[model samples]
Target: MELKLPEIPELSRQHRLAAQEQLDRKTKPVGSLGRLEELAVQLCAIQHKVPPDTARKRILVFAADHGITEEKVSAYPREVTAQMLANFAAGGAAINVLARLMGGELFVVDVGVAAEPVVGVKNRKVRWGTRNFAHEPAMTVEETLQALNVGIELAFEAAEDEVDILCLGEMGIGNTTAAAALLCLLTEAREEQVVGRGTGLTDAQLEHKRAIVARAVARHREWVKTPFEALCAVGGLEIAALVGSMIGAAASKIPVIVDGFIVTVAALVAYHLTPKARDALIFAHRSEELGHRYALELLEANPLLDLGMRLGEGSGAALASFLVEAAGRILREMATFAEAGVSEREEQDVT
Candidate 1:
């Protein structure tokens, strides 16, 4: 199936100028917030207003299964995916607690899971997970499109509700393996360059995992030509949904705060599909994963922080959102020197 991108909603010039004026008046010197001013500007574009107000924040934790788990590359078993989903719904998971503290709604969308999850457990199971890619393709092209549609719909709903920011998260065991493989195919990177120890793999196991991914790429070289093909060849359903969500956010003009390696890989594919979408991205932070740096370079995104975090679940991204919010607050609420009737520097006369 051909990938069809949605039409973008254009913002008026008056609204952008107004947002800029508001930013300049709030506190410090012009453009003092740095990229944060850019973030607020993009938010204004999405919201079609000046002085973007962050009234609602939403985090979408996409849950999916990875077929490559059959290779025993991951330390955790596949069942651990479903188990963590339960933990998330119960508010026992780390992300759940963080989300609660952050005062945002946490939503879990089940694009695919190997084991059928209970419907009432704060999960949306799309299918019983994807097939094993070690033996064959992870998913058919049709299924990939469906996953993208799900992400697009969810994002549009959030935009309609006036959500100013959306953080894309994921829950999938052995997913880093899939993310590395996908990154390799997209960037034409060798296995050794993009592969990393996901969730603490033994050295020997890491070598095994890398070799497996290398061989998988060689096997699907033909189908790995385009971004969609590469994703179908060795992509995680959650990653694909993230790609879709990024696209939807851009099409809607909302800002997306990206997390770790897996989520970054998805954003990479989304940018590949629509280069204009680049303007809507905010790199939340850098992960401890080996390949994350390479992926960030490929996207030309500098993360806001580097906390040595490898935990997926969008933890870093959620926390970084607060910083962006504070940046806005400081720009908009803090008193400026001129406003306080302070005199300018004597050097100003020389200039």
Candidate 2:
């Protein structure tokens, strides 16, 4: 199947200027709120509204298993992917708690978990699991397109439901190895720069994981020219879904709060496919993963938080939603200097 991507429209510069003017008039000195002001402007530009809608947030967790776990790349067992889906359904996971606290509806999507159908999770499985990229391509081009379409469908559904924002995350064993391999391929970084100790791998295990990434990248480098080709080579099904979701959200004019490392890799692919998609992305936080900084730099993104978070279940995005909401509220609800009769900053005459 030929994959058809949606056309991602650029954010409105007119709305951006309007948002900035409003922020400057908000009684605080210009840019006093710093990144908050920048975020508000971006939100306005994406939505083409003076104040973007920041309510009705949705958190989508894409769960799958990577066959690369066979390489002993991660500390956790592969079955943990299915077990964690059950935990998510039971509201016992950290993301469950965080989503509830942040007033965001959480949905778990089973794209390619190795287990049977998981109860209470969306069954959109493209396959049982991706093939081990250490030996060959992780997914066929057709399977990759299927996984991407599943995410696009979900994101379109969110847009129809009037969801104001989408927060992306993933659950998969040995996915860090896949993400690291993708980072090296996408950003032209070395394995040592992109690989990290996923799930607390020991020093020796981390080195082994790095070696696996190097080998995988070396095996697939020539054919992995496009971002889609790179994804087909070594990306996880959930990661492919993430790339689709970002593109789908952009096409629907919805902003996405991107989570750490793994999701950032997805965003990188999305950006590569549709550079205008970056206009709708709000990076949530920096991860403790070694490659996250490099990925962020490649995307020219400055994340909203950096609390040493490596947990990739949208925890950081959930937390950052509060700040996103606050930024919107500041734009919409704050009294302007003239409205509040506040003295404006004096312009210093230098002539």
Candidate 3:
């Protein structure tokens, strides 16, 4: 299938200016809210309004299996990917608990589990699992496009449901290896700079993991001509879908709260694919994963929190949704200086 991506417009400077002006006039000292004020302004710019409504939030967790797990990069077995999809459908996963507490609906999407079908999961599998990149490319260009279009369709579906905020998460064993490889390919960084001990690997396992990434990068060095091409070479199916989801959300004017390292890899793909998508993304938190900070720095993203978290499954994003809501409420409900009948400081001229 030929994929046509939605066109994401640039952030509205006019709305950003309006949000800032309103925030300054609130019943507080100028710039008192600090990052919260910045968050509000960015939300306004993304939504093309002074105060962007953040009421209806949705979290989509894309679950798949990576053939690279055959390389023993991750401590967990690839079977866990399909098992966790069942856990998600049963509302027993960490994302499930957090999403319920945060009052956001969670959806488990099976992009490529490489296992038996799980009941109650959205089945959009492109393949059983991606090919092992150590031996060959992870996926073909055609399969990559199919996975991406599934994400595009999901984004439009969320828009139709009136979702105002979207949070992205992923599940796949050895995905950290895939994410690390992608970071190296996209940033031309050394494997040491991007590889990390995923799932509590010992020192020896970490080294072995780095070696696998290096081998994959060396094999596909010539084929990685574009972000999508890089994804096809070393990325997971869920990661490609995430790239499409981010693009679609930006096009639909919905704010996207990105989770940890794996999700940031996808965010990098989307940002590289369309620079305008950055305006619609809200980096939820910094992950403890090895290359997460490097990826965020590449995007110039200032996340809302950092709690030494390395867990994926959108757990961080679900917790950070409250902060986004708080920012919106501050913009909409806080009283103006005049409304509060408060005394104002006299304007002083610098000139």
Highest lDDT against the true fold, candidate = 2
Write model 1 residue lDDT over 188-299, tens digit each, in one string: 7998888899889989999999999988888888667788888888997888888888888878867788999999999898878877666677899999898999999999
Candidate 2 Cα misplacement greater than 4 A, ranges: 347-351
lDDT of 2 by residue, 185-247 (tens): 887699999899989999999989988888889889977778889999999999999999999
Give me the runs in candidate 3 sitting further than 4 Å from their true place.
Answer: 1-3, 348-351
TM-score head-to-head 1 vs 2, winner = 2
TM-scores for the candidates: 0.92, 0.97, 0.97
How many steric clashes between backbone atoms does each model show?
2, 0, 0
lDDT by residue (tens digit), candidate 3, 1-351:
555678998889999999999999998888998888988998999989878889999999998889998889999998989888888989899999999888998988999999977998999999999999998999998999989988888998999999989999999998999999989989779999999998889999999999999988998987678887899999999999999999999999899999999999899998888888888999999989989999999999989999999989999999899999889999999999899998877899999
> What's the distance in Å from true for residue 84, model 2?
0.2
The Cα RMSD in angstroms, rounded to one decimal, for candidate 3 relative to the true structure is: 1.5
Tell me model 2's lDDT, rounded to 2 decimals: 0.93
Q: Which of candidates 2 and 3 reaches a greater lDDT?
A: 2
Question: TM-score of the candidate numbered 2?
Answer: 0.97
Q: Output the worst ten-in-a-row residue range by lDDT, candidate 2.
A: 219-228
